[model samples]
Target: MWSGDELDLDAYLARIGYDIERDGELAPDLRTLTALHRAHASAIPFENLDVALGRPIPLDLKSLQAKLVERRRGGYCYEQNSLLAAALERIGFHVAGRGARNRSRGAALPPVTHALLVVTVEGEQWLADVGFGWQGPLEPVPLRDGVRVEQDGWTFGIGVEDDGIHVLRSLRATGWMDVYAFSPQTYQPGDFTVLNHYSSSHPQSRFLGQVVAQRPGMDVRRSLLRETLSLVRADGSVEERIVTADELAATLEAEFGIELDAEERAGLERVHAAGV
Candidate 1:
């Protein structure tokens, strides 16, 4: 059960472009679940701008709602998945908060650095994640072994190993690659606070010294780093280029829908301060 008076379901639904509803309750079915997942992926971008800005990442629900929903900004895994978990709980879905280590960042043993949700609806479990950086699944994938789900020409598969699940993504020419692995035994609610601190401040954290952004639009999916911009076309072809530092703000505003305010613009300079 959700721990608040009530979640602003209406606002959340609208934020993600979910219109259909069931009187008072959000249905816990595959259609509704997938719609919500897809809408969120298309709407809210996955970004780590706040970390670069030296902003304190509050794990509270109110802060998440304000930043992600009201302010129309995006965040990394902890913020994104937390907001989704709350909404799913209010909608009567059984939600479990889980953490993972990004293999892309170089998988280490006993990892705990990412956030995701395992939602049980109608006795079936689905992996729901809205904050995974580029190549993340756009739809909720079944938590079953050997099943492949496609999202925007990319494919994802889950394999059960050693009491946990390993998420794999198709690499076009290289075949499947390990994305991340997670198990309940390794994840604790307390882990997020510790991980959040490290991810937000530690110099070695990938988010600390870079500007990363991603979001999928009607015709294409856009992604960016400090200087690189990549667009995945509908035909599965990718166009990539290197943009100047001066062009980053405009690109964020125009492509990712994040218009950096004066404070945010000032924060851009701090990315260089990190790792020093």
Candidate 2:
């Protein structure tokens, strides 16, 4: 594991509302790793606001830290996982960046658009992802078959596919859904640059106007689409509403803790318009 020469470990820990000293169990154990994962998933959010507003999403470390950590913003898979991997490395954890495809059971697999972390702690490999918009496991789960992990009302498991294990999540409608599939090959920063650009700029991309944001919580999971705002309780019950255009910014701030700047606010307006 490498140190954070350019990355600010303290600021990142503070941003995620995590105190390393309080954990008292460092050295990359499963307990501390789970703490870090839960804290990050709850505090920070998964958002595509920049894509909605037609802004560039850069993959550089400084740009990611400045936007997510300093500016108090959230990002999609590429940006969010990149920041988490850096912070994990700073804390002396063995983190490797891995890419996964948003896949289905029998359909042809799409490109590798999702970025996640394979962290090795105490000689055990754990899958760590904080940016999946849909709710999933709150803590790091072993990358093995039949390992069930539950967070709030959501249930997740790693399925042993022929190629490798696939991350799966369960809900009321679909019993289990395959979110993505990944291999052990570590991906480089350059691989994500192309994916981020395509995800952000492609006219037909889902991120263009299909607003998706989430802030996972212990008791409730708050999420937002272009117009709908959902509050899912711990009992698997959901209460949701269609947020008006005028209320989008405030909903984002109050519910998801995302305070948008002028550009982002205007960008949200554009996103809502295109949908209508």
Name the lDDT of candidate 1. 0.76
TM-score: which candidate is best?
2
Error of 2 at 111 (Å): 3.1
| Tens-digit per-residue lDDT, 1-276, candidate 2 | 222456887888899887756766556678788888888888888899888777789878899989999999999988988888877887788888788877643477677777788889888889999877656557887887888777666777787777674655454344666777887788776776777888898875778876778877778788787788899876668999998778888888898889988877887876875676
Q: lDDT per prediction?
A: 0.76, 0.79
Best by lDDT: 2
Candidate 1 TM-score, true structure as reference: 0.88
TM-score of every model?
Answer: 0.88, 0.90
